[model samples]
Each structure stands twice: as structure tokens, then as C-alpha cells.
Target: IDPRKTETAEIASAHHFIVPGSDAYLLLAMLQLMFERDWVNAGHLAPLLQGVETVRELVAPFTLALAQERTGISAAVIEAMTEKLVQTPRAVFYGRMGVSVQEYGALCQWAIQLINLLAGNVDVVGGALVPNSAAGYVKPGERGAGHFNRFQSRVSGLPEFGGELPATVMAEEMLTPGEGQIRAMLTLAGNPVLSAPSGQQLDQAFEGLDFMVSMDIYINETTRHADYILPPTSALEHDHYDFAFHRLAVRNTARYNEPVFEPEAGALHDWEILNQLSQKLGDHKGIDVKMFPAPSAIVDQSLQQGPYGKHNQRGDDALDLAALREHPHGIDLGPLTPSLPQRLCNEEKNIRLVWQGIADDIERLRIASPPQQQGKLLLIGRRHVRSNNSWMHNSHRLVKGKPRWRCLMNSKDMHEHKLADGDDIVISSRAGEVQTEVEQSDDVMPGVVCLPHGWG
Candidate 1:
């Protein structure tokens, strides 16, 4: 956990959070605890934070016991963690990929942000800071809601990057017939079929697409569905500047990688390949300027703007093209300043903790009082940094032999299911079922089960 992103000096003065699988249940408990003990920092709240009163009223019924029952976490532990979170002056709550790929993934992400808001960490230093990369731009682009929010998936209503969501919906779009049925797809450095929900269903959906293209190194699970595959050069062959990673980096640091190999006669770099593709695609219709700006023009302008560029230095930014050329390793920007009074992509120049879309969805889920299923094993996914999926399975160093695949069932649940460790058992959900070997571990909660991803 990076302190720069998690430290806030407002409500609780401390930072804390729970693991992914436990988020939904534990977060509700934290909110309930805050309300129960009057831990909510009412004085620190912004006026636009909606449903605070409604949330207070709603959490009344969800007592500690109820939370423990739903989430399989002990009430005593939840109480302790809640207290720790509120006791410190600058704390942040953080969750990443682990929390964003489940059934309640979005809800969990929203909840983490809510906790940060309730703690008054928004916009403060040592708290989650917004990106300052906007200052480094040339020609000063008008920054506001661009045309990126209008386009959505024809089937599942997923928004595009400009308006469409992640290409995870590529499979669903293929099977669903309507406007924008997705006759073709262009995949870049992604494998959705194995990594996305309902992989089997996604596999079938890809068959429906008229054409599929992939820009990748090796043909993996998703690439098998493509009509044409464009193999790009390996990482070593290209110079690297991680623009996105910089904005998201916890600490202010910069590093650049130089190409190890000299350019061959006809070989193109990734940027060159992308630029050529954009020109062929015509007009940059669905492309974002941030991603595909006219490289030559941008470079020329950047050269004129000086090293740090026009955005960061206002024509005085120390960074200029000559400096960059001299120092190819990159320059560190150093620790960022506290952005407590600054706006982070917000129109009002403040964080929108409880936005309209999120607040409305929470309210709907609150009123539904949906039925909970029994005898269902919660299947959670796990992976190591060394390997992402079956694509890396062939690497002997990463995966020795079929990854240690098994459903981590608590010893108590193991007995309840009349199952033994290493026994073949059928794990089923309402949607479907698969046979997985069982591995009993005391670390798993009584009702919870852990499953390694990419069984196929």
C-alpha cells in the first residue's frame, strides 16, 4: 500500500481496509459501525454527498451480527478494524484488480471510495491524489467531458472508453444482435476469453463476430478466435515510457527504457505500428487524441515547449527535448504536493464521493432485499504475479505443471459437504458447474471457498 495514495488528514486520521472477497460484507459492517458509534465525520462532509441520511437509516437494521452472518467475518474483528481505520489522521483505503472482477466488484470499488470519503481523505495530501499529467500537455486542450461517454455496448449497455467500457463485453456483443453488433474486433495486448466472466460463453460469442484481429506476441486463448494476428516486437526491441503508470504511481518517480536492438530495414516500432494502423483506420473516429495524437506534430511541439513541456512548466518547465535526449533514463518528478484544495478531474474541483450513478445504484440494491442463496460455495479467483493465465502456463519457471488448482474450502465446510482434501468434487453455481479438486485450508472462512483461475 502506497502511503501517498492512502494517507488523509481528516475524519479518522487513519487508513485501513479488508481483502477482496470480504469487502461487500466487511464494508457494510464498517458503515454500520460508523453509524452505530457515531464515527461518521459529519462536519467534514461536502454538501453534494447525497443519501447520507438515507444510508444512516438503512444501515440501522444491519447490525454486527447480521454483517458477520452475511460476510462470514467475525463481528469482533470488524469492530477492531473499524476502530483502527478511524483513529489515524492520514489514512487511505485502497483496492485494485482483486476487488474489481467479481459479481459485486463495482459495488466493492464504490464502497472503498465511500470509506475514503467518509474519512474526509478526498483531495488531501497523503490521500488519493489526482493526476497532474494534464499540466504537461502542449497547445492546451480543453479538458472536460469529451465525447467519450456517449457510446455504449449495444447489448449490455457497457460504456466505451470515450463512452464504451472495456472490451470484456466483446463476447457478449458478438452474440447479441442489435445496432452495433460488432462485426469486427481489434484486440491489443488483451485476452478476454480466459480472463473475463463466463469464459465458455465468451468463446461462443466470438464465433458470431464476422472478423477479429489481434496485435499480440503469442496466440493465446482469445487469439484463437481472431481472423488475423499481428505479432508485435518483444518488449526489449522498443523504447518504453509508461505514461499511464506514471499517473497511477503511488510515488512520484520516472523511468524510461531504451531499445536494445537497432531498427531493422523494414521493422516498425509499436508506436509506428499503431500510427500506421490509425491512418489506415481513417479519421481516428473512435480513437482518443491522448492515445493517438499526430506523433510528428506533437513531438515538434513538445520540442518547442521545453523539457517538462508546456503543460507542466507553462513554457518554463525545466524539461525540454534536449534534456530528454541527454537523459534517456527519464527524470523523477519527486514527491507530489498535497492536493487538498485541488480538483481531480471534477467539474467542481472537488472529489465526488457519492455521485449520481453510484448513489442511485446503491439505493436500488438497498431497497431490493434480494434473496441469498444457500449451499452455494463462493468461488474466488487467485493468481501470482509471475503468470496471468493459461498463456503463461507454458513457462516452466512460472508454472511447473498444471497450476496448484483446487477449491480452498475451510475444514469445517469440508466436513459439511462430506468431502475430503484432494477429493474430486462438483462445484456448481446457478449458472453452471465444474469439477474441481478440493484443498482444505483453515485460512479460508467456514462458508468461503478459493478457486484458482484458468482451469482450462
Candidate 2:
């Protein structure tokens, strides 16, 4: 975790790709090397692999020079990182809050997956093991023509996750005049305006929405715009199970925490609210809907339809919540099952890296109108340990030591602009502009700026 630590016994070599804002480009560069050098073990990938040639072709344009330019990373540094991966033991590459919220967020995520796959580090010891939790291994929802393979938003047709796009377009969907424009929004555990793209634009868009509903624990920026705010119980009030991270950890470990206190006031559990809203929306309120059903039902349903469904043909009914809870924390799922040869999505056993449609989208952006050359600063979002999204923003202890939000600038860049640290500055992006106090930090490279989320 320390940047100062040299590549060592536990670590081999560490290289930082100054590819500040975009994680996808950095990943492409690494994948390009794996293909070009034949470092990937083809045999290791069995029936669960799909679309290898497509991936290779997609990454072809992201040569060292191109990536360096696109990501602001030095080619030499990228190459050095590749070298370290080739020489290190248990060398694991990771990225967290940094790449998850960006203009090209999904691409960044995909690229990280590609790097892990090519390096043969997935689900392996000291590698990028899928973290599992006591929530049980229930797969995500199904992917279909209406789902995966298609983009829905007007400006950016980002691929859908769980039958929906990035949720970045929620505000816009309601504002843009159209027949299919969103008339209602149901946000479950998300704050789009603070976490999504085009913050200024989104703010304007929210004002135009007919009905905005928020299911959250606390009232914050985005929720303040809602017509109805449904409060959900805080983490301490509910049983905790991290279903997503369990599959990604090196060693399977599970921890269970019983509710610290009984539900007080009118605060309802998150799952209960989600179920209530879904039934009301689906117009089937009379029938009971188990939002978070038994793990077996979830696993069976997901395996039968989700992206991983086809791969796991003969699933057992034994995998359920009772089974998971039997061990209290969780049962270690062990190493990742094989994936290369068999296609997880396609019937054929191959890897489809290109995702032609995604490639086309990026290509369009490349050729699209360039960002305005105005002096506005590029806006970026950062996360903190205090809360997720805008749920607990009012916590006095959390916001007391820091500005609710910050405008981070490279010291050199600040000096060049003749702007002093702590001075209020107007930041303008193609989306719009906002005023925030500036803070100088050497952590960010010159010419770039960062802003913490949860502040207007």
C-alpha cells in the first residue's frame, strides 16, 4: 500500500501508470503485451472462456505510445510494470475507488478483468481472487438482447448491468423530452448526481423529473431532489453479508455481524423496501415477492439465466442461506474454477475481447467533438470510508476534519495558473462548471484536477 516500498520479496516490482483518469487504457496496454508475447496459457482456459480474437483485435490500437498519450502514463513505466508481472511471485494488480467512477468506467473495469485473466492470476493464490461473502454465491441477474449487447442511454449508451445502464443517465432520462423519457425513477442504494457523470447537467435534469424516489438511510444532495424519500435501515441495523466480494478474494473468509440493535423508529430494512417498491412497480403487490430469497433459489435462477448460468449446468440445491449461515462467516469457495476453453457467454469456448459494439462506441468518442478548450478544470470524484454515496454525509465527525468537498490540483499546475491553494476556483467541463476551494497536492500529476464527491 505504501508508494515508497520498493519491489521486494512479497512484492516483485511496482510500476504506477500515471494513467490517472482512465483504467481501461492501462488494462489494454497490459493485455496487448500478453497477446503479443504469447504469455497467456490457452490450455488453462477451458470451457468457460469466450471471445479471445475479438479482445486481441480490440487492444491492437492501444499500443504503448497510444496508451501513454491517452492515459498520460509513460510507456517506459507501463513496460516496467509488465516486466514486474512477468518476474514477480504472487504479484497482484488492483484498483478500487479510483477506476469505478469515470466517463469510461465500465471499460476500465473490463480492462482490469482482461489484465487479470492474461496474467493467469484470477482466482489464484496471492492473485486477484474473487472475494466471497456470507451472502452466498448467488449469480447476478440474467443477460439478454434487451440487456447485455445493447446500449440504452441517449448520449452514452453504456451497456446495461442488472438490466440497467450505469444509472448515470437517470436524471437525463427524465429531462430529455421524448415519448419513452423516464417518468419515474427508483433509486436503490445509489446517489447518481454525486457519483455519476456530468454533475451540473444532472442537477438541471433532476429539476425536470416528474417523480423522483429515493430509498436511502439519510437525506443528502440527490435525495433532496426526490419527491418521496423512503428511508432504509443503516448497516448496523441489518445482517451484513457481502455477496459480491466473496468471489473475488484469494482466501475465502466470511464474517457475520448480527444487528447491533433492534430496528427503531420507522426505519425499514433495505431489502424490504426494495421488495415493496418492485411489487408496486411490477403491479403485483398482492403476491409475495421475496426480494432477497433463499440462496438456493437465487443460485438456481441466476445459474439458469445469468452470464455464468450456462457454464454451471448441474447446480446443486444444497447451496443455500442455511448452508452458508451454518458456518457463521462463510465457507471458503476455494480457487476459481477453470474458464479459458469454455465460453461463459457464448456456446463456443473462446474469449471475445473486442466486444465490437463497445469498440465502436469508443471509436465514436475518439472521433466525436473534442472537449471544449476552455480553462475549466476536468472534474473527478473520490470516495471516503465514512459513507457510501450520500447516505451519511451529515455525520458531523466525518465532515468535521475536512471540507465537505475538495478541488485537488497539482502544485505545479496551480502555480502555472497563478492560483494559490485554498482559493476558490470555477471548474468548467463540457458538462458544466462548479465553484470549489482549491487544495494543492503532489499526488495528482500536473494539468489534472480532482474533486471529492457529496458536495454541490
- Top candidate by lDDT: 1
Q: How many pairs of residues in model 1 come into backbone collision?
A: 25
Q: What digit string (tens of lDDT, one per residue) describes model 1 on residues 1-456?
A: 111112132243443333334456567668878878877772344664656776666555556786666555568877887787776677777877666775567777887777777766655676665544422331233455555447766777776655557656766777777777768888887777777667777778776678988888777778888999877777777666565676677666445556788766776655667877776666557644434653434543544442255544545455544445566766666665554433334455444445555555555555655346476655666654456555575567877755376777778889998988799988776545778799888655556677766664
Rate residue 343 of model 2 by lDDT: 23
**lDDT by residue (tens digit), candidate 2, 1-456:** 211111231363443425345556667787787788777652254234566777777777667876676666688777777767755666566766567655666677777777776676664566664433323343334244234735567645655665666656766676777667877666766766776777766777776778888887767656778899888787787776554665455554544445788899877787667776767856754665546663345544432443223344425533444444566655554555433232233444355555665677556534544345255445556544564455566677665675656677877788889989789988765567778999887665565676666666
Q: What are the TM-scores, per candidate, against the unseen true structure? A: 0.77, 0.73
After superposition, candidate 1 runs with Cα above 4 Å error? 1-22, 42-65, 123-126, 130-152, 157-162, 166-168, 177-179, 263-265, 281-317, 320-330, 344-347, 368-371, 394-397, 417-422, 430-436
> CA lDDT, every prediction?
0.63, 0.61
Which 10 consecutive positions of candidate 2 have the poorest summed lDDT? Answer: 1-10
For candidate 1, report its TM-score: 0.77
lDDT of 2 at 185: 68
What is the lDDT for 318 in model 2? 35
Candidate 1 all-Cα RMSD:
5.9
